[model samples]
Target chain A: MSNKVIEISNLGKQYRLGQVGTTTLSDDFKRWWYAFRGKEDPFLIIGDTNDRTKKGSSDYVWALKDINFSVNKGEVIGIIGKNGAGKSTLLKILSRTTAPTMGEYKIKGRIASLLEVGTGFHPDLTGRENVFLNGAILGMTKAEIRNKFDEIVDFSGVERYIDTPVKRYSSGMYVRLAFAVAAHLEPEILIVDEVLAVGDAEFQKKCLGKMKDVSGNGRTVLFVSHNMSAVNSLCTRCVYLKNGTVYSIGDTAKIVETYLSNESNAESCKVWDPSVAPGDSVARIISARVTDDKGLTIDHMLRDQKVGIEFEYEVLQEGHWPIPNLHVFNGSEEYAFVSVENELEYLSKKGKYRSVVWIPADLLNDGRYVFGLALTTMKPNVNVHFYAENVLQVEVIEDISKRNTSYNQRLPGVVRPQLNWETTLLSD
Target chain B: MADMKTEPDEEHWDLVVKPKSSLFTLNLAEVWAYKDLIMLMVKRDFTAIYKQTVLGPLWMFVQPLFTTAIYTFTFSTSAKLSTDGIPPILFYIMGQTFWNYFADCLNKTSGTFISNSAVFGKVYFPRLVMPFSVVISSLIKLGLQILLLMAFYLYYYFTTDQLHPQWTLALLPAYLLILGVFSLSLGILFSSFTTKYRDFTFLLTFAVQLLMFASCVVFPVSMYSEKVQNILMYNPVVSCMEAIKYSLTGHGLFSWYYLSFVLLVTFIFLIISVVIFNRTEKSFMDSV
Candidate 1:
């Protein structure tokens, strides 16, 4: 016999995206008629897969399309995607929470899913009762549950509140108990969604440890999350989805790299026009660009090189306001730094000002970053001018050979600028 | 390291390890396997009903007793309905006890999909377990109410010295069987519909109350005209209530042919309900 626990072939799921009314009824009839006659659905031909993110003319969207993969026994796979990328839909289909519109899958083991916490818990029932209820819902027999009941309660750390109704428990306590029952049930296959997004950091660590132990016991797991670091640490393989189709599948590091790079490339900056940007009082941002020191257009830059942003705008009136602000964001769309021209003080005498903001050499660390600019009235609590988002792109590079930084300083966060450091042996 | 390289054995496990067909078959063995869960659900429903209440389980007896008293006073004396030589209290209590079982089953079962959508959306089990648990839970209430009816029956039997009570009481099990079939089928059927059109949920309680009067819960079916009786017999619940009343006091007449007709109709309804429930379980979360 084969060791594969799940074999899926050409799995597809389509959904109608609109209010359920007469129009949908007629369309459903049409689709059902074609399906009855063993013909391809006529509506599926409207939009190509290349532009799935764009709103289509039809009211239907395929949530998953032609997905094919196989999972061997004991393999833990992480599924990653942005919002509306069909990651949840794929998990739902595999869990049998919903059926696919087309294709098939063969699952060779008992599957338990922790899609959400407190799923099977009744508000009026005690925590002790909910454990058994949730376990049975996951297909565990009473004797099997009885054998692990103490372990579940212990892992949950809610022993004192075991007989108290879950309704009174805090969300953290509830999730801890719920996840404990799910992970301890010992199913042959486990599916978990982003339920770890709840609970405290310490609880998240505990849940992750339990998941690792579960996968270590020769059971298969399919995990879906947006946390790249956790995915890197937990999964043996990774699948990246984009607009309901498998974009790539391979090793976790390679797949994450491909997904992140592709995401940045797909969001290529668009030219700005005053009419397209929304604002009330002040002048709007007409255009913005990033360039090298030689004034040549550049998308990527070295970590220790100079970078410049040129802002072009048309002033609505001669005003003492219109403070231009620049914000820089790291690859994950987190704001890295904000610089305001309010300190220039020279711009207070300007009319229809155009200027460039420059960063000197040897400042940023290695990473991709996007730049945004806004032209707003300097006064507080007032609606003003226009803002342009993700207008300029910059990339920083690192020399892999250099290894002087301490371990604590290597992690990525909101700040990546180098700072002066000195050490002295004072009393020795 | 050698133990780590060895593949885990799959044969020793009792879990269903084969690929399931999209069309699920009723696994009677699986239900047998999860019987403890069914028992737990039943216990939860029974004990939790009056958990925070002052009277606790005593309220179970009090509810049926008060309903029977009001029903005897209103239907027997005020409406002047004939009890067919049986005491009014015994006649009404018999009908009310059986009818409540049917109503409880229907009301609870109809809300099965909506009520358990959270659990169903998260995990996979025999979805049939939920509706089946409702039937089992309602049976507990039925058993309690029947015990109260027995208490009233003994009091009437000893003090009034009612004749012909022994023979009719022997048919009580058959009456309960018929009632069980009727309620289970109706509950599953309504549950399937309510999963789609939630408007039916609001109408369910009022529908049950209106159905109680038409099924002879408070009055005898013989009190109505023959035309009304014919119309009432078309309702499966009417046969169940009439069967229970006839079996308890030996008052109303019994018809095996009509009871068989009710059984056949109920069988067809149960088949339809199971089929719809199976299909709905696959995709109901989309609408819910």
Candidate 2:
């Protein structure tokens, strides 16, 4: 027998993007006419692959276009994408929750998907009843469910409330029971969405471990998640998606790195002007740019390198104002450091003023970071100025050549604390 | 952990991406494979309906019983309508019990798309199983009401010197088969329509009630003129209900031609229902 468990070719999904009503009827008639004449669909020609992001002249958009790939047995793949990138649509099509608008695929084994937690659960039903209901929905036979019932209950940790209605249980308890049922379903292929985001850290770890065990048991798994760390740790390979199309499909680390780099470049260096800013204030942040001391724009920088943020603004009226301040933030959107030059107060004696905020070397740790800058007037009120949020990127790299320090040192929050620690034992 | 030092084969386990299937079959055969799920859904519907109620399954009998009482008072007493000499209670109960089954099936199945849209939206299953299970569960209610009819029949039979109905009673199963097919067809047809034009939901209850009156549930169709009788017999349910009473009590009307007509109509309805249901299943998720 061939090792391939699933094979797909030239798969595409076309979706109509307007109110689905009379338009559907007319479109159906047009599709029928084309089919009757043995011609390709007229509406399909309106969408071009190169400009997939652009809205088509017709209401139809190909959510997935020419998606071709094959899956051997026992492979775990991660689908990584930004929002609205057709990731969920692809999973939905594979799980048979929906069908593709075009193309065909053949599966050699049964597939079970956990697209959403508590999907098949009825809130009014008890957990024990929902177990069977959801299991049955997942295509498990009664004997299979009976064999795995105890393991499912034990894994969920809701033994005490197994017979209680799910509506009465906490959401965490509900998700646990739902996941347990799905995890133990034993389908040949398993598909999971990013529903683990709702669970706590410990539960997420448990779920990820269960997923690893599942894939290890020679079953295929397709996982969709925005958590790059989890994707990198769990998946053997990943498909990166951008704007409803496949950007790249390859090594998990490389794809994730590409995705991160693209995101950093897109949002990091933005040319701002008075018209583009949101707020109507005394001062407006006209432009903000992150660069090295040599004035070259950079998204990745060394941990100990000096990073500079250039800010340009045009003052509406000439007056004394507080000096510009810059704040650095990490991926979690938490502010890491705020540098303010309050003592060096200056007035906009001219039409426009330019300033640059600098961070000295060795002040940050290794990770991706964002920068925010504000130009506030200090005289009238603290907030009388322009403030930009999360608009710059700075990445810190650690030198792997160094061997004196442990590589597993803890990195917490947006900033790494550079505090020194010393230990001594006291004797009686 | 058992083989912690073993070098896992990383090259062979790489992710394989593929295009998704364009065509999907609902596989009613698979639904047959999961027959236990059908039974469980039926049981859940059966138990949950009356679980917390004080009267429990007693509510099943109460509906037909009260409707029978009202029919007996309004048509038998107030209007003094002829029942073709069969007892008023037997006639009314027979009509109410049989017609209620069909109505229940129609109403429940018609609401299947709207009532369970939330559950159906999140999960993938043979959507047909839902309405099929509803029809089966309503049959249980029909079975209970039939028992109540039998009780009244026994009381009237043993009390009076009237002879029990002849071997034609064997045809009762035939009548029930016709009713089942007719109701299933109408129910599925209405369900397919209600998935889109939800205004049908508001009109459904009133339509069922008006249909009950027109189907001769309150009185015998024999009481009407020949012109009206022909018009009423055009409704397949009227023929099924009249056939049921005729088989049980040896009273009102029985015509092989009418039964054949009803069978033909029922077959057409069922074929149409299946066609519409098949078409609706493909894209109802989008519309619903």
Candidate 3:
């Protein structure tokens, strides 16, 4: 049987950005008046296509525009994009949670969307009741949930709390129960958002295993997540979105490489103007930059080259001995290391101060990594004044041309330790 | 989830989503497929109301019983409202029981978009199921409350020579169906409207109270002036509530002509509300 599940074409969703708390009654009147004329909506003409970098000219913006892709049955497709790149919007449209503003998509077979772990879980309900309730919400029949009832409870490992209300369960237990019910869903087409990075690490492994079991059954899956490593392992294909449009779509590895390299290339250096300095009056991050030893702004550096992160901040208060810190997370969003300067000598005064931290050569793995900075007063009162997450990103790619060994592949880990190896022949 | 068993036509697409969706696409199959979910929602709404309460489901019976006493005191005693030879307690309990069913459906379904926005945004189900569940659960409550009305009914039937039931009681099933659908239609219409503008929520509570008076729930339609009766006749709910009274007591016109007119109006109202609801379901998450 030739198996194909989904075919989407020219899909788009436009949103009107404003103070949505209360729209004037006149706007409703205008919309009705224009809708009656059989003309294109009067507001649609004023919509600027969604490009977050550019200052939009109108209140209307397309959350997803002209998105086109097709999935053969059993293909696990990963969708990766930046915060505003419309990944969620595309998933919403495909899952039928929300409709596209334009164009169409043809879908075969039943589709169930696990957009979040517990989309419809009622906290007051018992865990067992929530299992049935959530399963039914995800398009499962009562018999299906009943048959999988024990398996779901066993998978969640919350048997003791089965009869207790979900609200009484800890947050981790709540996620496990919610995810257990979600895992029992066996729809032909499954659409999942970034709900996998929850619970303990072991449950996440079980979830990934369950997803693998799903696609192994020749079921099509659409997964959206910012976790690149998870996508790299689970997806055969990938769709990269940029500003509400498809930037690229193809092999998972190639598309991921393209998304990471292109994304970091544009964000190697970040500057916060005085108007938009993202901090309270206590302190403000002026600039954060990733550079090489030669002081050149670099998106790509040799695996052995020293990487430098320089963060300049303007402190506007005294008695605040601020500790500037950096947290490095690898491409998979795992925290590689955190380096905070806690030297007791420097009492931070009201002035522009810059802190530069350098990483030794060959210390980090040959992969993409991002920087997060925080300014906190950790003395009498440990209060975090400001923290800038993902201030800069860099890629430490292996130089293939300079390889000597037969195997010239990058190793996988948070860091690559280059320790001296002593190999003396024992019985020469 | 049920399997889609048709042969895979690689060239043929199953659904085409366009900017202008077909307005009348009810997709009853999709709704039916989610029937289990509808039942759970109804169960949840029914039980969730009485959870941790002292009286539990007894509150359902007690509410209408107490309201009957209050209404008899206010409308029958002070205002001297006539009950057409039926005793005041039995009359008011009957009116309140039936009107509560309609009012509950309208109140709950009207807030469907706002209240369920959290679940609705994260997942996709036939949005009609929410209001449909409201109607079903309200029917369940109505069934429970009807027992209290029945007690009064049986008391009045044996003791009082005034009670006279008509053969139109056979039409009670059809009347309830009309009443349920009419409430669903209006509730869904208001639900769709409240998604964008919240002004209707406040208006709805007041409007339902006004609707009860307009339907002649507390007073006989014949007691009104001719011009007022003409206006009340145009309200489909008047036909619905009056038909119920006529069925039980056989005191007024049990006219099939008026009942059919009410059904037609309800059918039209249902279609219009469904259109508005379908459109809102697609993009209400954006504005809601």
Give the top-scoring candidate (TM-score).
Answer: 3
Whole-model lDDT values for every prediction: 0.75, 0.76, 0.85
lDDT per residue, candidate 2, B124-195, as tens digits? 677778878877887887887888888989999999855258666788777877887887888778878877
RMSD values, in order shown = 5.1, 6.2, 4.7
Screening candidate 3 with a backbone cut-off below 3 angstroms (N, C-alpha, C), the clashing residue pairs are none
Chain B TM-scores of the candidates: 0.87, 0.87, 0.93
lDDT of 3 at A341: 86
Interface RMSD of 3: 4.5
Q: Which ten residues in a row have the lowest lDDT in candidate 2 chain B?
A: B13-22
Model 1 chain A: lowest-lDDT 10 consecutive positions: A265-274
The digit string of per-residue lDDT tens for model 1 on A155-201 reads 99999999998889998899899988887867788899988887899
Over 4 Å off, model 1: A21-53, A265-270, A278-280, A312-326, A333-342, A346-350, A354-363, A374-389, A399-428, B1-24, B166-171, B198-207, B224-235
Q: A224 in model 3: Cα distance from truth in Å?
A: 1.5
Task: Choose 2 or 3, whichever is better by DockQ.
Answer: 3
| Candidate 2, A115-199: lDDT as tens digits | 8877657767788888888888777877889999999999999999998988899989988998888889788888889877867
Give the DockQ (2 decimals) of all models.
0.36, 0.24, 0.45
lDDT of 1 by residue, B131-240 (tens): 77888877878887888888888888888855355365576666666677677777776777777667788788798889888887776788888888877887777876
Q: Is the docking of candidate 2 incorrect, acceptable, medium or high quality?
A: acceptable
